[model samples]
Target: MNPFRYERALDVDHAVQAASQGGRFIAGGTNLLDLMKENVERPRRLVDISRLNLDRIEPLSDGGLRIGALARNADLAGHPQVLRQYPLLSSALMAGASPQLRNMATTGGNLMQRTRCYYFYDTATPCNKRSPGSGCGAVGGCTRIHAILGASEHCIAVHPSDMCVAMAALGATINVAGPQGRRTIPFEEFHRLPGDAPQYDNTLGEGELITGVDLPAEGFAGHYSYLKIRDRLSYAFALVSVAAALRLEDDGRIAEARVALGGVAHKPWRLPDAERMLAGETPGSRVFARFADALLEGATGQGDNEFKIELACRAIVRALEQAANGTPQSQVDKRIA
Candidate 1:
């Protein structure tokens, strides 16, 4: 790791002041530390906010949730309110890294995580996200895990976060504090697509600190699923993951729906077309197939990951089916050989 100065923040104001001078904010240090060790991220200073009083899970008056950014993944996943109300989020969190990692990973850090692209992590390789204006090595190189949607010629990397996928589907709001002041950002607008400027991941401003996320009151608890398909499953990054939520009327007709895809784009790819198609349709294989087709309408994969288009289609259908049947994974779903 590169030599860097560190300071423990006394509070949110202190954190903002300390980080306003181009220092990186360190909470759980799970992702940032790894990047620093790999020399992918070399911050001159780290403002430690883990000691700040930003670690609480409170219920909002409007039946929503106010999750502190410093809340650990394990605690957030296992929280009674989360498991009972936001099962989709719980499942997604549990499907992510191991227990030890979950214990150390913070919600804010997870939201600020970088892509798991091999080229981005390899200093020898040219990656636009890593080094601006550098040629993208994954464009024509090994792209089995690259994106299939919202990918620009400059970069084709995908965001790797199960929690963000569910949060995107839930329409959460991210609260941020900065040198200027505090503001809230819609979940959908938080992360940006990898356009020409692949170097920037999200829409966060300079010297901004993520304080927490606000989940709306209306949740898809009764019918929601977070299905992650991977190579070996346990602790592996997602090959294709689906976060599905459906609110079916008493007559078995869908009243509302939300679907988001991970491991396929720069951010959690929301399927608005598929969601519209599912609005009035009944839950069935035929309907699910149509939903999946709508999701893949504009998807074009690279050579090695061309198979992901079809795989994502099948995964979407399966995830929706499970969600409709109210059988989202409570634990990690693995196929034992």
Candidate 2:
């Protein structure tokens, strides 16, 4: 790692000031430190904001959750309010990384973490995301793990945050603090799609620090689940993942639904068309399958990852079915195990 000066922040204001001086904010250090060591990220200074009083999970007056950016991933995932009211978010967090890493990782850090693209991490490979105009190595190289949606010719890397997937479905908002003060950004617009400017990953300006995430309450409670498919059983990134929340009427007709996808896009992929199809319709395997098909429309896949389109569709269908039926724990265990 390059030699850098370190400063412990006293508060949000101090952190923002320090960041304005070309210093990188350090919270969990799970992602930042690794990138710095790899020489993928080099900062002259590190501002530690772990001491800031932004670690609370407060219930908003509007019937939502105000999650502190400094809140640890494990704490946020295991919070009773999150588990009961926002089960999809909890499930997505639990499906990510491992217990140890989650214990140390923070909500804001996870959202800002860079993609796990092999080329971006290796200094030897030429990647536009790593160094603009360096060119892309994944275009015709090994790209099984690359994206199929919202990808440009310069970058095919998928966003790596599982928590953010659920947040996207829940209509979360990001609160950012910077030298110029504070501003809120909608979750959908916070992470940018890989367009011609693949080097820019988010709407956050340089030196801006994410303060917290606000999840606005919607009425899609009781029916929710997160399903992640990977090559291994545990502690692995998703090949394709689904975060779904649904509401069913007394007559077994869907009243509402929210769906977002991960591991198949440059950002969290939400399908309003699929959600619209589910509304007022009876929740059945056939209905869920049809909705999944609608969601996968226009998905362009590469050679090796063409199978992902089918796998992603099936995963979404299965997740919706599981959420609708409230499958028994034993049955779910058998199926997943």
- Give all candidate RMSDs, comma-separated: 1.4, 1.8
State how far residue 147 of model 2 sits from its true place (Å). 0.6
User: Per-residue lDDT for 84-176 in model 2, tens only?
Assistant: 788778878888898999999999999997899989999999999989998999998888888888788889999988999999999899999
Q: How many residue pairs collide in each prediction?
A: 0, 0
Query: Which pairs of residues clash in candidate 1, taking residues 3 or more apart in a chain or in different chains?
Result: none
* Best-performing candidate as measured by lDDT: 1
Give the least accurate 10-residue stretch of model 2, judged by summed lDDT: 328-337
Q: Which runs of model 2 end up more than 4 angstroms from their true locations? A: 328-334
What lDDT does model 1 reach?
Answer: 0.91
Whole-model lDDT, model 2: 0.87
* Model 2, residue 37: C-alpha shift (Å): 1.5
TM-score of 2: 0.96
lDDT tens readout by residue for model 1, 124-173: 99999999998899988999999999999999999999999999999999
